[model samples]
Target chain A: MAAKKLNIKDKYRLLTRDLDWDFSYEDPKKAFPYEEFEGIKITDWNKWEDPFRLTMDSYWKYQAEKEKKLYAILDAFSQNNGHLNVVDPRYVNAVKIFLTGVSPLEYQAYQGFAHVGRQFSGVGARVACQMQSLDELRHVQTQIHAMSHYNKFFDGFQEFSHMHDRVWYLSVPRSFFTDARSAGPFEFMIAIGFSFEYVLTNLLFVPFMSGAAHNGDMATVTFGFSAQSDEARHMTLGLEVIKFLLEQHEDNVPIVQKWIDKWFWRGTRLLTIVAMMMDYMLPNKVMSWKEAWEVYFEEAGGALFKDLARYGITMPKYADVIEKEKEHISHQAWWTFYTHGHAAGFHTWIPSDQELDWLSEKYPDTFDKYYRPMWELAKEQEAKGERFYTSGLPQLCQTCQIPMLFTEMDNPNQNSMRDTVFDGERYHFCSDGCCDIFKDEPEKYVQAWLPVHQIFQGNCGGPDVGDILSDYYRMNVGVDNMDIKDSPDEQRWNKWKGVA
Target chain B: MSKVYIALQDNDESRYIVEAIEESNPDATVIHMPAMIRIEQENRLVIERKVVEEKMGRDWDVQELHINLITLGGNVDEDDDQFVLEWKQ
Candidate 1:
């Protein structure tokens, strides 16, 4: 018996890419339908390069380490009265939001990446897709396992899967990803790889890790940090994809330029939720959205755009949109958290006077001038034993499904409004494009499964507010009294508060 | 309209390239293909070797092209006929 050996290039060209063949009697575009719609050209598929020289053995080894680490944390949290260990039941609402808003996106990422693996024209891209698909699946499973520990002690945890599918806020993410999925593969690269991963993933991962660390959530911090480590590689892929497109064809520069404009705006709007969560949800906030933006986007990404200027492109069209909304997004989400948190799995209390001063110092430009008055009103309400919910369902922007808080392009104060008629019923949108999209397919947009509406309709498994909050959202009613728990950590926190 | 093709390492670099191009030409139209960015310029599109050379600096090598690119679409032609950079409109 004899063993045959293949050289590196030979193995790649022969075993991997060389095996692909043009199908007989089928249009190439149909076989690869997404490639031609936007009118970008590709004469040779072989020039693509795979940066990661990964093999199956290496892949499995790394994956196993990730799983072992994650499962251990889940076990510790489950067995050690982890729910009782938290600073407050309100703090657990952050976890509830994670379960409902973000965990499902991981599954969607897995499916989308699987399509990436199978449909990409380049072998390296296929490999990238494979790796990301697996990573996404891991994220989903890990998030579920970690959050499930609180399911016994909290409310809203149970209804997350259902809520994710039907909530107004949830529509933003679902629609955004669906838009990418509907596009050609190259557009997907632009939307997810370039726009989402490269420009914003750092913005996302850093906050998650930093906030978790600040809150003594070692498990979440560890998982987020680990995920961020992998994100760096994905970011590189995004950068490479953009460059390759421009260098590949002089014509491609402009086509990619449009996608950058469109998707950059789209992705930034979608990340409003992240911006709000980072700035508001945590009892111990780390970085303001403004500061994070300056460091991550302004410093790092702004420099990258400067370097890119030589290649004949500009910053995305809606760069100013993200910049302008920084203060408002966090402000609105905090308001939401402060008001609705009691009904959900989390708790919300007035910030200590010290925390208020800290906030003022952190947001010198706007906090004192604009927000302090609002906070004072809230405090007065709390003192009087009255809490406010804005009485009616908010008018969600069709594109982002955030309340229509975004002002005009430059005027951050003047409300932006757009409308479209669907099935002869007029719908208001915060932006023109969103209205247009809804108008194009009225049926799709009209069927939105809004979460607030569900709660009002008494669909969340309870006869009253307390029952629903406990059974569905997963709030702690009995075990530890939320912030004043039986844990040593709570004792220490209480003692520290007494000192000041 | 001329057709071109560019190959790069991944999509992020494709974005950099697109941004670079749009910086110079704001109205430029772009289309995305599986592994490339296709551009259709109403006028001419040029890639000054000196520009790439200057940015890459001492690390510049033609083979590094693979490390730098991820998008290839729209009127792109590079590396003789072996690689097509642009998609024909």
Candidate 2:
């Protein structure tokens, strides 16, 4: 009789876990020093399950297939001038935000995972992190390649990596990853692997990808599908990591909870940009940010947290605040960007009359009440050859690094600002959530590379905002940064379509 | 009893899986959203490897289900031949 074939489980065990050796000469503690420092006790590495039973050979095979399929579509998109097919030139600004504001974070995730992949004593976790690190690297590469076609036809795409580092708003995402990468391995796992990949990724990807599809950007939509295929593995690993940490020892619960609270708040803040993109930037809207939040977070996350309740983890802190902010954040974020259009990497504009009506329909209680008036006034100003741009730099949250644009959930009229004196210096936060996070780690936050502060201190090359825009931020003055109404991007689109 | 669900991105790959799921779980209701397809069943839902393979007209790895999976609720019991989702009693 022929020998029975080895099943996937045994194959995975032999290929992955069996390869880990007993540390005889070098102390295992010396090998994985970061594990104990985070106060997460893993009593048994043996209990850690491989979330998906993908061995490296099969991982490469599947990923290769996805790459092949994705590249074919991307090549087709480029050859066919996919940039011209989008719903409007306004839609490309969303892609600009994504490439500049979001893509480098993928690179950061790669570095973060690659770092943690080495630090874990548990071979299962190390291998999981390694795979996710590769996925992040691939995601960044594919995202750039997918958007590269647009770079040829667009302006803001030129200085994405540079802008991510120096641009004021881009720091929100930049600092988020930096904070995660600098933490201990376990904290990194919870901050990114679990809280980000599992809890918040849908909010980021789904809206953007769906918006891409709705707006006829086939390259982005295809890449979104390809990246999302990898995301399943990342998401499962996130779930397994949290479960393993919680199940290992009772002491880990509170530490994990604290990380959850901090990262969840940070994740929400980081997603404010995505919320703005979903609501304001997409000419052909998929759904309002409020609706997406309701489905992805309130319904799906609610269920997941309910399941987590068994592990003594409840829904993250400030759930009520987050739920309420969904109705308000997109409007607030777009208004800030609209006012600061001259300083932004991408073009911004007042939403069309139809878009304003859509906002009113979507945000029944708040849109017509608070935000529409501002847009109307901006419209009137634009009509009279007096477009508005805020001359002074806004103060950024010390923790989240977002401009203090968000309002109190209860009182939408009032800016939700909080502050604390740390080491005899006052640091401001955008909300109670960010303020609490800052207070928890004042030493970490005090060292934040706030762009406005850097400009004031002359660390940024700026006697004038123009000098800063060109020399420091590398944004092309009058070309890359401004309203889409009469911008070159708009002119080019009209010329291509033979529209006056 | 509360419902259990699995959401998959609405695409070609998931169409076969959703069909397989519809055949396998008769009580389940499938709802299509903007870019996602959600299948909800009372208390339990299962995806059989054999059923998916038949619907796909090829060999199917149960792990491939993750390619388009958006989110899922309930306790999971997964292996090579079958993937089952249900709450603990």
lDDT of each: 0.61, 0.88
Q: What are the C-alpha RMSDs, in order, of all predicted structures?
A: 10.8, 1.6
Question: A1-500, model 2: which lDDT tens digit per residue?
Answer: 99998777887898677999989999999998888987888888988787467888878887887888889989999999988899889999989998998889999999999999999988888888999999999999999999999999989999899999999899899999999999999999999988898868877876678788889899888888678778767877887888899999999999999999999999999999899999998898878999989877887677778778888998889998998899899999999999999998889998989999999999999999999999989989988999999889898899999999999887999998899998999989999999999999889989999999999999999899999999999999999998988899989999999999
TM-scores of all candidate predictions against the true structure? 0.72, 0.97
True contacts kept of 1: 0.00
Off by over 4 Å in 2: A1-3, B1-11, B33-36, B66-76, B86-89
Best by TM-score: 2
Best by lDDT: 2
Error of 1 at A484 (Å): 12
Mark the 10 consecutive residues where model 1 chain A has the least summed lDDT. A479-488
| Candidate 1 lDDT score at position A255 | 83
